[model samples]
Target: MEKFVRVKGVAAPLPLANVDTDMIIPARYMKALTRTGLGRHLFQELRFDDADRERASFVLNRPACRDARILVADRNFGCGSSREHAVWALTDFGIRCVIAPSFGDIFSGNARKNGLLLIRLSETLCDHLRREIALAQHAAIEVDLAAQRIRLASGETIAFDVDTDDRHILMEGLDDITRTLRHADAIARFEAAIESLMTIP
Candidate 1:
């Protein structure tokens, strides 16, 4: 897991609302059984036409929005089936952080577990940021997990709310497994004691 302290990169605007997991990566592509390669199918439906031709109008397909690390989206982002692949696709595509007014509960959990920062901010503020990025190519957006704030190059900051424990996880690049490993010595000692007790009369 990579520590998400302060990420400054291209801010892609995904202005649509109710962007569910299936839309992020179609369920058909979910058969891969591995995290790698999903980036190629991220937003498969929107990125291409029915005939499999590229759609130039989609936000992510735009030349300037490619390789965007931060996504400014509308309400209810990540809304459908809780596919972990959705998180994989976004992260694989270089999107380290996502800013939206609301997010699906399951998808949000999966994202945090995978080391992606999901930010919740006012819808108005999110819109402002989205538009700002579209107006400028690779417009820089800074997300500081320790500070719980997202700032644009212009110096405007939007404070977001995140649980203390989750915030700590992002700052230290700790997933659930990593968090448990933090107490490895204690766990080993307890196991050793249990083994000795079982062997005694």
Candidate 2:
């Protein structure tokens, strides 16, 4: 997992709502447990046609959005199945932050654990950002996690709320395992104390 203190980069607009995990990476590409190489399969169905050729109509296929690191999507983004692969695919595609009106519960957890910042804002704000990205070629969005705000190209700033623990996890680049390891000494002491108590009894 990578630290996500701040991100200022091209934002791709995904206007469709109810985007599920399957649509993100598709179930066929979920064979790999590792997070690497999923970028190629991200949005496989939308990015490529049945013939496996790039679809020109897709937003991600557009030249301006090719290297987009921020994704501004519609409501109910990352809905459906609880597969963690969805988060893996997005991060692997170089997307560091996802801005939407709402997200699936499981998907949200997966994203946070993997160091992907998921910002929930009002529907109106989401629409504004999406439209802004579509109209401006090579437009960029700045997300400052420490500040809990998004800076748009029009010089407007929108505030968003994130769980405090999630914010800390992303800022510090700590995954679940790493987070647990942070208390290694305390855990070891507790285990040793319990063992000693049992032996005395």
Candidate 3:
């Protein structure tokens, strides 16, 4: 997982609500356990038609949004399923942060673990950001995790809340395994102590 201290890049507006995990990356693409190469299939159904050809009308297919790194979405984003692939697909697609009014509980956890910042703001704020992105071509947005604020192109900054521990994890680029390894010495000591106790019994 890559550290996510701050991200400044183009933002793509996805105003639709109730976006589920499957929509982020369809289940058919879940055959691979590795996170790499999923970017090609991110939003596969929406980005491509039945013939698997790129749909020029899709927001991601649009020239301005093709390389967007920040996604501004409506409420209930990532609503269905608990697959971690959703976060993997987004990260692989170069999306570092997602701003939405709400998100699924499991998907939120998955995102944090994968070093993806999921920022929740008021519905009104989300709408404003989305509209701002739509009005401009390749509008740039800044997400500063340390400051917990989003700097918009209009010179307006919006504050957001994130758990302190999750913030630390992302800043330090520590995944669950890395986090556990930080306490390896203590874990080893405890295991040794347990072995000694077992021998006495």
Residue 160's lDDT in candidate 3: 93
Over 4 Å off, model 3: none
User: For model 2, how does the per-residue alpha-carbon lDDT over 1-201 read when each residue is reduced to its tens digit?
Assistant: 689999999999888899999999899999997999999999999999999999999988998889999998889999998999999999999999999899999999999999999999888988888877666665787999999988888888888899999999999999999989999999999999999999994
Q: Lowest-lDDT window of 10 residues in candidate 1?
A: 130-139
Q: Write model 1 residue lDDT over 47-154, tens digit each, in one string.
A: 999998889998888888787898889999999897999999999888999989999999999988999999898899887887776666567878888788788877
As a whole number from 0 to 100, the lDDT of residue 138 in candidate 3 is 58
Segments of candidate 2 deviating more than 4 angstroms: none
lDDT winner: 3
Instruction: Tell me the spans in candidate 1 whose CA falls farther than 4 Å from its real position.
Output: none
